[model samples]
Target: MVILGLGSNLGNRAIHLKRAISRLSRGSGAVLHAVRLSRIYGSPALTPTGAPAAWDLPYLNCALLGETTLEPGALLRHVQEIESSLGRQDHRRWAPRVIDIDILWWDGCEIKSDDLTIPHPEILKRPFVLEPLRDLIPDTILDSETVEAHASRAGARASVGEIAHSPDADIDVSYPTLMGILNITPNSFSDGGRFLEPETALMHARRLVEEGAGIIDVGAESTRPDGATIDPATEWARVEPVLHGLRALQGEVRSLGRRDPFQISIDSRNPSTIRSALDIGVDILNDVTGFTQPEMLEIAESTDVPLVFMHSLSIPVVKGESIPPDRDSVEFLISWAEERLAEFDRRGIKRHRLVFDPGIGFGKTAHQSWHLLEHVERFHDLEIPLLVGHSRKSFLRTVTEKPSAGRDVETLTVSRGLVEKGVEILRVHDVEGHATLVSRHHSDRLSQLDAGAAVKP
Candidate 1:
C-alpha cells in the first residue's frame, strides 16, 4: 500500500493534479497498479503567522492510494522526478507552486532518513490532507486517531470542501467506459422480460459487472418510442428490488476482495422514481424527459445525484415522428441543449453533475440518428461528459437490415467510433465486446505514444 498526497496552488490546478496522477501510474517501470484517487478538495493555503493574507492562494488537494512493487526509496525518487518534470520550482515554504507530491505513508514501514519520512508529520494536523485521505482510506489510523476524526477536528480551523469532479467523483470516465443496460420493462426493445424478476436481474447485473461493465443503467420503464409508460409505483416496483440486490451484491464482491465500485444509474423521467432511486443510493439520474418538470428541479435541490439530460421531442416518445429533414437537426439540438443547460444552471445544479445524451432514436429518423453520431464530438464544447446510447438502436437496423438482437456487431462498431471521438460513456447491452474494444483502443494508443516519445529529439 502506497499513500501519496498531491497539491497544487498555481497554474491550472486540476490539470497539474491530473497530469501528475497519469505520470505516476505510468512511471517506475510500470510497478504501480490499481490506483485509487480521491476527489479534489479546495483548501485555504496554510500560511505562517504574520504572512500577507493577500498573497495566499487556496490549494487543490487530493490523495492517491496505489499498489506499487518498487521499494520505498526508489518510489520516492521516481515521484521526485515526476514533480520536477511537471515544473515544480523551488520556492519558499507554503508558497504556491505548480505541483507538489508528497509521500504520506509507505507500506506501514517506518523510516527516519534525512531525505524521506514514512508517515508525513502533517497528516494529522491538516484538514486538506486528512479530508482527501479519509475519503480514499477511511479506516486509516494515524497517531492513534482515525483519519475521519482527525479531519473533523482539523476542519474547524482549516476549511475544506470537495469540488465537483468532471464526470463524477466516484466514477472514472477518463476513458471510454462500459455502461451496461439493465431494462426491466416488458415492452423494452431488447432483453426486457428476461430481467424483470429481481433474482434474474441481480444475476444478470452481477454477470455484467463481472464482464467489465463500469456502470449498470437500471431502467424500470421502457423509453422505446411508442412503448408503454407505467405509473411511478409500478416503475418503483420493478426497480427497487434490483437496486437492493445490486447493493447487497456489491457488499459480497467487496468481501471477496474486489474493491472496484460499481455505479448505479437509474433511467427514468418520473419524479417519484427519482426520489425512490435516490433514497436507495443511485449515483446518477438519467432522465429521458430532459428535466422539464418543476418536480425534477425540486429533486435536484433536494438531493446531490448527478443528472443526465437526454434530448427528446416528447417525455414518452411518440412513435413514427422524426425531426423534419429540411430542418437542421444538429442546430436545433444544440439550441435545445443549451436552453436545458441554462435552466439547470439557474436551478443551482453544478455543471460537473450534468451530462447530455443525444437521445439517438427517441425522436429521430434513421438518417437523423446517424447525423447525431457523426456530429457527437460537437457536444464536447458544452464542457461536460457526453453519453451515447447507440447500442441496438433502430439506426443500426437501417444500416445492417438486422433485428435488434443481431445488432451487437454494429453496436461495437458505433461504440469504437464514439470512443475514438472521446465520448465519455457508452451505454450498451453488449458489455464484453465494448469493454474489449475500449481496452484494445487505449492500449494501441498508448503504444503509439510511447513509440513516438522514444523517437522524439
Candidate 2:
C-alpha cells in the first residue's frame, strides 16, 4: 500500500487533483487502490503578486492514498506526466503549480533515488499535507514513528515548508569529501594534453593524493560533446601512466608519513577500458552511459564495487565550453535522476553501492544548471552521497561574464552554492582553493544554523 499526497494552487485545484488521481490509477506502471483527500486548504500567494488582482489568488491543496507495484522512480514520472496533463508547466520556480503529487508511503519501503524520494520530503513541515495524509494512513509508521507523531513533533507549518525527501528518509552524504578528476584527451578545455607526459602525470597524481582526495577519477576516454574517441589500446595508454603513478604514491604514502588507502575511480563508458582498469585495481566506475550499456552492469556487478552513475541528455557532448543553461530554468534534473536510478536498480545494480552525480554542465542549459544548484537539496532525497563536477564549466563563465580560459573565481561561485546545499564530493582541479573556501565558510554556516536552531521560542 502507498500513500500519496497531492495538491494544486493553480487553475481549478480540485479538478486538477481529480484528473491526476484518475490518470495515476490508469498509468502504464501504477495501480490506483484507494484515496482519502483532505478538505481543500487555501492560502495567500507565496510569490509576490504584481497585479492588484493577483493578491486575491488563493492556492488550493489536498492529499491521497493508493496501492501500486511501480518503483519509486517510475511512479514519479507517471505523476509528473499527470501534472503536465492537468496543466502543470515545468517553467516556474516556486510559482503556482497544478496537480503536485508526492509519494507519502510505499508498502513501508524506504527509497531515495536521483529523481524520486519516497515518503515525500517536507512531510514534517506541511500541516496541509500531513494533516490530510494522517487521516488517510492513520497508522502509517515510518522509521518507527507514526505519521501523526512525526508531523506533530516537527513544525509542519513553518515558513519554509517545501519538502525534498520523505521526513523519515536519509539524505546525508559524506560531507567535506574529495573527488580528484582525470581528463584523458588532448583537447579537454582545462588540462587538455598537459598530463600526457607520464612523469608530469605521475606528479599531478601524487599531488592530488597528498592534498586529500578520497577518490581519484582517471578518465581514459574524454567524452566532451563531439569529443574524440580512441581505440582500446589508446585509451589504456593515456590512463596507464597516471594509474601507475597512483600506485607509486600509494606505496610512498605508507613509507613516508600518511596512508588513507584512497580509492581509485575509472571514468569511462567503454566496457573494455573499464575491464582493463578493473584488472589493474580500479575501485569505482563512473559510467556516463546511464547504465544503459549491458557490459557496464556486468563489469560493475562482477567486480562487486561501487559505481558513480552520471546522467546525460546524450552519451556525448555535455554542455560545451561554448554553450550553457539559462536563468529561471524549470528542467527538474533531480527528478529526472530519480527515474534513471530506477532504471539501474531494475537492471540488478545495487542502490547502496551506487553514488549519484547530477551530470552538471552535461546537456544542461545554463538555466538547468542553476536549477540543479539552487535545489541541490532536492537531490539529498536520493540518500546516496553525491558528487558535483562543475569546476571551470562554460556556464559559470557565461553567467558571471568571466572568461572561460580559466574562470577559477567564477566557478567558485557555483561551488559555494553547492556546498551550502550539502554536496559531498566536489570534483575539481583546484584542490587547495576548494578546500580553503569550504574550510572558511563551513564554520560560519554551521554556527549560523546552530544559533537558528537554538533560538526556539
Candidate 3:
C-alpha cells in the first residue's frame, strides 16, 4: 500500500485538492482506500531568506492511502502532472498553491532522487501533516518515541485540527536498522581528501565492514558549511574512483566470504548526481538539502531507492558557488536544521526509509555540535534512524583536547554516546576501532541474553 499526503492553500483549496485526489483515484494502476483531512492551518509563509512572509493564502492538508501497481516514482510523476494541470508552478517560496499530492510512503519501499523523496520531507514537522496522520494511524508510531510524545513536542504554534479518515486503512512500516553517511565533497572537513584516493578509500570501506558497517557511503561533493566548494565534474571525479572501488569492493568482500556486506549510498544534493549514481549500482541516496525543491522530490518519486532525507536550516544553492560553511553559527545551524527536517518530512518522504542527521559540524560551531548531541534524543521523536558522524570531527577533538586528525579515542567515545541516543550510524575515519568496540559489546550482550534465556528456562 502507498500513502499519499495532499495539501492546498490556494483558490478553491478544498476543491482543488478534491480534483487532484479524484484524478489520482481515477488514474491508472492506483486505488484510493482512505482519506484523512486535518483542520485547515493558516500561517504566514516561510520564505527562503528566513522571515515570516505572507503567502496571502491558507493551507489545507490531508492523508490518503491506496495500492498501486505503478512504481513509486511513476506514481509521483502522476501526482505532479495532476498538480500542474490544477495550475501549480514556481511563483514564490511559500506562495499559495491549488493542490499538492505527495506520496509519503509506498508500502515498504525507500526512494531517493532529484524529482522525489518518498515519505514526503515535510511530514515530520508540520502539524498540518501529523494531525491528519494521527487521525488515520493513531497507533502508528513514525519516530522512535510514541505518537503522543511526538505530538506534544509539536507545541501549539502550528495548528492542525484533526479530521477523520473514512474507514482508515492500516499504515505501517518496519524500518531497517542501518544508516550510512555519504559525504561527497573532497573538502568535507571530516574526511578531507582521503576518500579521493580510491585505494585509501577502499581501506576505509573495508574497515567499516570489519567494524560492523552495514552500508558503505559514497559522496561526490562537499556541503561543509563555510568550506571549499567544487563543481559537479570535480565532485564526480572525487567520487568516481571511490565509487568504482566501492563496486569492486562489493565483489572483493564477497570473495572474502562477507557476502552482502553493506549497501552503497550516494551522498549528493544534485539531481544529476543522483541520476548518475543510480546508473551504477548505488543502493541509496542521502540528500542534505531539505527536499523543498519540487524537482528534488520529483527525482526521488521517480525511483524506489532508499533515501536519507536530511534536515538543514537553509535552502542550498540551486546552481551556484555557495559560500563556505559557517564555522561559528550554532543556532543558525541547529534550529535551521531542525526546521528543515520537519519541513522535509512534511513535504514528502516516508519516515521509515528516511534517516535523519543533525548536520554535526556543517554550519555549526563546536559548542553547537555539543549542544545538539546533548539534546540529540529530542530528534528521536522523528522515529527515523539517526546518523551522527563525529569521527575525527572538531567536536570530538574539542572534548578530547586534540585536533581533528588525532582524536580517534574521542571520536569512538562520542560514537558510543550517540548510539545510546538512538543514532544508527557513525560516519567516521576510525571505523575499525568504533566497530570493534560496538561489536564486542553487542556480542557480550547477546551472550548474556542467551545465558539468561537458557538457564532453567
Candidate 4:
C-alpha cells in the first residue's frame, strides 16, 4: 500500500490536483494504481519566515491511497517527474507551486535518504496531511499512535477548511448533489399512499430539504413497472397543490437567509403535466421516457430549464423486456444518449441544459442494471451532467431482499460508488442517509478543520 499527499497553491489549484492524480494513475508504466481519494481540503500555506506575501496563498490539498509496483526510491523519482510535468518549478522551501506530491507512507517501511523519506517526517505535526491521511487509513499505526489519533490532536490545534462547492470549482471534483424523491401517488412502488394528500406531500418535501436535498423531484404519477398509469389531468391534480406549497416553502426558506435555495424538479413524462409544471415555475424537467414523444420535444424546445433525459425501454416498464442479450448495455445507452443530443442540437436545444440517467431497474434485469452502473463512466464521454435514480429500486432489493422502503442502506452503498465515478447528481429516496454518506466521504472531519485554530507543532 502506498499513500501520497497532494497539494496546490497556485494556478487553478483544484485542476492541478486533479491532473496530478490522473497522470499518476496512468503514468510510470502503470506503477501506481489509485484505490481511494480523500476529500479535498483547503488550508493556509506553510511559508518560511520572511517569505513574500504572494507565497502565502492558501492551498487545496487531498490524499491518495494506491498500490505501487516500484520501490520507494523509484516511486519518488517518478512522482518528481510528474510534479515537473504539471508545471511545478524548483523553488525555495515552502514556496507556492503549481503542484506538490509527497510520499507520506509506503507500507510501514522506514527509510531516511537524501532524496526521499518513508512515512513523511511531519505527518503527525501537520493537520493538512494528518487529516487526509486519516481519511484513508484511520487506524493504521504511526509513531506509536493511530493515524486517527494523530489527526485529532493535530486538528485540535490547526485550521483547515473543506473545499466547499464554488462557482469556479469543476463539478468533477465537487461532491454529488442530492435530488430527493417525492412521489405523490397512491400506487407507487415505494411509500405508496403515504403522501397522496397534498399537505402530507408538502411536509415530506420540507423534511427532504432539511435532510440535505439540493433538489426536490416531485412526481405525481409513479413510473414503476407495476405502477398505475394516470391521465395528464389526474397527474396535474396530484401535483398542483404540492407545487404551490413548495413555492411557499421556498419563500420561507429564502426568508431565513439561505443563499442558495433548493431547486424544484417535476418528474413526469406527460405533456400536459409538464406544461403545467413549467407554468408553475419549476426549475427542472425530468422525463422518464427520454423525450420520445413529439409534444415532449416541443416542450424541450420551448423551455430553457435543465432537462433530465432517462433511457428506459418503456414507460411503467414492461416486464421481461430489456436490452438484447447480445448488446452491450453501456454502449447502447451511450449511443442512445448521443442520438438524443444530436436530435436536440438539430432542434436548437442547447446541450448544456441536458442530463442523462441510465434508468436503472426500468426495463432491466438485476444483472443488467448492475452491469450498466459498473461502467457508468462511459457516459461521461457525453460531456453533460448525469443523474442516477437508483434509490429503492428492485435491482437493489434483489441483493438485500429489502422492501422498497427498507433499501436506503443498499441505495447509499451504490450511491457512494457513483459518487466516486464523478456522477454529478444522485436522485434518491432517503436524502439524509445519502447526505451523511457524502459528507463523511467528501468532508470527513470538516468541522474540526474549519474551526479557527492553528496546529501546535
Off by over 4 Å in 2: 1-174, 256-259, 318-332, 442-457
- How do the candidates rank by TM-score, highest first? 1, 4, 2, 3
lDDT of 3 by residue, 57-108 (tens): 4455666655577777677677777677556875454666767677776556
What order do you get sorting by lDDT, best first? Answer: 4, 1, 2, 3
Q: lDDT scores for all predictions?
A: 0.75, 0.63, 0.58, 0.79
- Highest lDDT: which candidate? 4
Model 1 quality (TM-score)? 0.64
Model 4: residues >4 Å from true position, as ranges?
A: 1-173, 445-457
TM-score of every model? 0.64, 0.57, 0.52, 0.64
Q: Residue 287 CA error for candidate 1 (Å)? A: 0.6
Clashes of each: 0, 16, 49, 4
Better of 1 and 3 by lDDT: 1
Cα RMSD for predicted model 1: 13.9
Candidate number achieving the greatest TM-score relative to the actual structure: 1
lDDT string for model 2 (314-413, tens) is: 7557334312234333235556667777876677665645778877767776657766777775665565556788888766755676555477777677
For model 1, residues 1-457, the per-residue Cα lDDT tens digits are 8879988877546545655665665422444566666656666678899877654876777777778888888988888876765668665776777788899986678888898888987778777788767666666778887777777777666523533223222223235557899988788887769888999888899999988787899998887777776999999999999999888877887798643467789998889889988888888888888888899889987776668889888756788887877987777787888899899878877665677888898889888899889888777656566789989988887779888988999988787678656577789999888767756654553353334221000
